[model samples]
Target: MAKSEQTKAKIIDVFLGLTNKKKWDKISVKELCATMGITRGTFYQYYNDIYDLMEQIEDTLITDLNHRYQLLPLKSPNGLFPPELFDSKYDYSPPQELFVWFDFCKNHQKAVSSLLDTKNGDAYFVKKLKVILAQHINHIMDYDGMPRDGLREHFTKIFIELHFMAARTWLDSKEEDFLSIREIINLLNTMRVGAGFLSNKQMTSPDFEAKMKFPADREVL
Candidate 1:
């Protein structure tokens, strides 16, 4: 890499290291420069301030994440998957994109973990991730012929929140023997399928129809 690019990367690396050691708000440009044996002027050339540096880092990560997700072959020109692809008789395989996403997370575990830390991390960054996940989930639900009504909308919100939190937990684990990406994907798929089954069963129940009615329309208990 060029000298300037290397310097910038080194700066980011130092910042991420500091993030792991202390709360984000407590990290200062002076300390970062001192740690890197660089002058404040050099830091200012690359970043306006600490917050600016953080915003740039987060923007880059989120942009890359969104691009990766957009590349998933969830739909064709018609914006829907082949109906047969959903058939129970057909053997199903997990999308390579999922593996890619998890691998990215693993590779950037330091940055991701630091940024997603509950107490000190950026909530805005987490919100951006959820937005990406929500879009992806909506596309999958669309292709799966799931209704986009109130109940399903609420379910989708819950689903996104659950998976995002699980991902954060996985990233936060310090153990070397944490679940592998493929295994986690399989578990997630199982949860999704189980949820779908319960949703279908619930929708088919007679009580579901009655529950859908206006509260006042129901017979008084």
Candidate 2:
């Protein structure tokens, strides 16, 4: 890497370290520079201020996440098998694409955990993640022929939040307490598969009625 890029990376690394120990508001540019033995002028060359650095980091993460998501070799609805084909006794595994995602999170654990910290993290970053997850969920539902009504929309919201909770739990856990990435992936896949089965049953029920009206302006994120 070039000298400038290396310097910026060093700055980001130190910043992430500080974020783990101190609240976002407690972090300052002076302290960051001091920690790296760099002058304030060098810091200004890369970022306008502390908040600017945070925003840039958040943007980089989101962009990379979206790119990775888009590259996933997701199958179409026609390629999906019926949920009935698998039972509780069946050995279940998540798609490799999901494993890739979990791996990314694991690799960036510190940055992700700090940015997702409820007390000190940016809500905007969380909101951006929700938007990305919602899009992915909607794509799956669309391909699976799931109805896009209010009920399913609500389900999507709950599903996304459940994932966030699971991720946060895994990310924040100690090394000794940490669950394997595959285990977390499998757990999430189980929930998704179970939900698929329930939704299929619900739609096929004799008394089923699609009465819920999704508001035109309702935002799932």
Candidate 3:
């Protein structure tokens, strides 16, 4: 990485570190610079203020996720999609490259928590998330019988919002409320089922069953 990018990343690291420890409204630019071992001037060279720094962090994350989403294969390879899944198959589990989105949140729990804060406006992060997610909606949703335009796009947007908030809830929850990844994936499948869009064959497929396995299912086996 270039010197400038490294400096900015360090500053963002400090910002996210502090953000996790305290309320977003309580975090300050001076603290970020102090932790980064840089002057306020150096900080300003890269960002206008704390919010600018926050937006930059969000944008960097979103752009990387968008890039990852782009790399995902449009359809499962000849052997990747099981013959058992057939036409109703949609890789609802996040695409392999986009799995980085999960890693980003896991590594930046505090940062993700900080973005969920509504003190300023969280719509910015949510909107950015929508863009990252919306593009891959087709990969996850069954499109064999549906048009790509109109209602399809609308529900994809809604499902993106639902997925985002569900993820946020999972992040924000304590052990009691925590939603495991499998549970969440099952919830997503359930959502499709409820939408009257999921098919019986798809629901019963080995591909779906493989991805939807729970701990209990393993125990039973």
Candidate 4:
């Protein structure tokens, strides 16, 4: 609760508030400073730019997840995923000492939604996320047999992108009917199980793709 830390947090609050209202690219330094009631010099003292501020916010969340919440070292082989990472259904406050990504999202839903709107995380943030996910899904990806590097990478990529899509859909539409968290969980479970099955099966990629079709051989382009 030091003055400097408090000031920085207030700036962050204003920054996140702005993100909810506009694209991250559109929010300028002057505007954010005006919202914070601080001079540009003050902002510079703590952050280099808006991106820096956002990254710091992310860093703080990661720190809490790792140390305070103990969500770090995420369980693997189908461990620490949606619904499980989130608090109980329709709730935000995690059970005592139980923290997950949803806890942070609940607090900054608007801003996080904005950043995700950019889809930039697919390259940057998701790279960081994949590290955690890989540790957890690696076992499942090769459950039936040993997978080559390419196989693991390909499955991991799909897992991260699909999860992001599901998460984005849920965050954008908070309504229970918009997209059930259970459905998202099911999607993830499918990927986990699919990875295992594909590992054991001798079918080639083409063979697997051939079996997956849309009704008739009608292509909609």
Clash totals for all candidate models: 0, 0, 0, 2
Error of 3 at 152 (Å): 3.2
Per-residue CA lDDT of model 4 for 8-126, tens digit only, reads 97887787667766766567889999887889999999999978887887776555544533534532333322333222321222222112444455565665565566533314554
Tell me how candidate 4 scores on lDDT.
0.59
lDDT of 1 by residue, 165-196 (tens): 66787887765757767788887666556655
TM, every model? 0.79, 0.79, 0.61, 0.62
lDDT per residue, candidate 2, 67-185, as tens digits? 88878877665333454643432333455546656776787788888888887777888899888888877766655555567777788788778777777899988867977777787
lDDT of 1 at 205: 62
The local distance difference test score of each candidate is 0.73, 0.76, 0.64, 0.59
For model 3, residues 63-122, the per-residue Cα lDDT tens digits are 766766666667643332443454455434434433555555666676676676545335
Query: What's the candidate order when arranged by decreasing lDDT?
Result: 2, 1, 3, 4
Best-performing candidate as measured by lDDT: 2
Q: Which ten residues in a row have the lowest lDDT in candidate 1?
A: 76-85
Off by over 4 Å in 3: 1-10, 17-28, 31-38, 45-48, 76-101, 142-144, 147-154, 174-177, 196-221
Q: Record all residue pairs in model 2 with backbone atoms less than 3 Å apart, i.e. clashing.
A: none
